[model samples]
Target: MAGLYVYSVLVVLLLTCGAVMATKENDQIIKENNCETKMGLPCFLEAFTSIFETGSISNKCYVELVVLGKVCRSALVKRTLENPLFKDLRPATIIAKSIQTWNNCLALIDSPSPSA
Candidate 1:
């Protein structure tokens, strides 16, 4: 029950942080800039940390999202979006999934121990 509470709080915190990683418009920007990437857990975590620790999205990251299409692309997403049937919704879905994946990765990253 404690773990579940923590998880729920984490999600709520994430949602309340004004995370700009939402919306179909962002998806379109990501697609237009061709900044999509196939990043592993570590890479995604690092990138997210840089943003979250600063309490906002950095200009470089924002520009990448808006002008360069630098989104967290996955092999699975690539394969699925390749199907023409889902074209209209593909970009937004991939972006949303990538954000979800990154959040999960962030949760698993150990916080620095005070003893250290």
Candidate 2:
């Protein structure tokens, strides 16, 4: 019984440490990419929900997301997937969708505007 308790505590400690390390890494990525400042709160939430849930991103938010850049976008998705709340989600499916979203946004940004 005591051994089981110790094992449980160790497991908790390990999980906490891993989460902290991941958060720090995420912070560094965010800072380097200027993610927080580049994407406003509303747009960030829109992009996040669009990725993790069945939702669509608005063109305005898409612009913000594309400007936020692929590195920041990928890192944010990876960080969210690591959260316990997303444990049931299939990482590969979500990751594929993320890439698709990025590609779509990039295409929109790259396309020439209609001649006025």
Candidate 3:
């Protein structure tokens, strides 16, 4: 439906904004705050890695991500859910969209090759 398209576009914009504004300083802040006190860095990375690998979140991973959202305030999980476009969607649905967006975004990155 037309509503779905608009909603997807909004998700794309929000994800793009989050990715664009990210910098080394922001990464350090996120690590210092969320990784240590709120959530583990490996947990965060694994959630993302699983999303891309599975094309859908596992039940355990979903629970972990929800808990991460609850305990951490500075990360995308909170803001992504708060966006007007996501207000009507279920938490799982929002996460699915975000994961899909993340997969797309990561595809845009050019990985560095090992030096010979």
Output the number of the TM-score-best candidate.
Answer: 2
Q: Residue 26 in candidate 1 has what lDDT?
A: 49
Alpha-carbon runs more than 4 Å astray in model 1? 1-73, 109-116
Clashes of 3: 0
Q: Estimate each model's TM-score.
A: 0.26, 0.75, 0.31
- Please write out the lDDT profile of model 2 over residues 1-116, one tens digit for every residue: 99999999999999999989987898789888777788999988888777788788898988999889888998888888888899999999999999988998988888998998
Where is model 3 poorest over a 10-residue stretch in terms of lDDT?
A: 104-113
lDDT of 3 by residue, 46-113 (tens): 66455323454444445455555432433555444545665675767556756564544344333454
Which candidate do you rate higher for TM-score, 1 or 2?
2
Give a tens-digit lDDT track for model 1, residues 21-89: 343444665566444453344444444444323234433343333332224334334434545665675
Task: Compare candidates 1 and 3 on lDDT and give the better one.
Answer: 3
Question: Model 2 compared with the native: what TM-score?
Answer: 0.75
Quote the positional error of residue 51 for candidate 1 in Å.
21
User: Residue 46, candidate 1: how far off, in angstroms?
Assistant: 24
Error of 2 at 34 (Å): 2.8
Cα lDDT, all candidates = 0.47, 0.88, 0.54
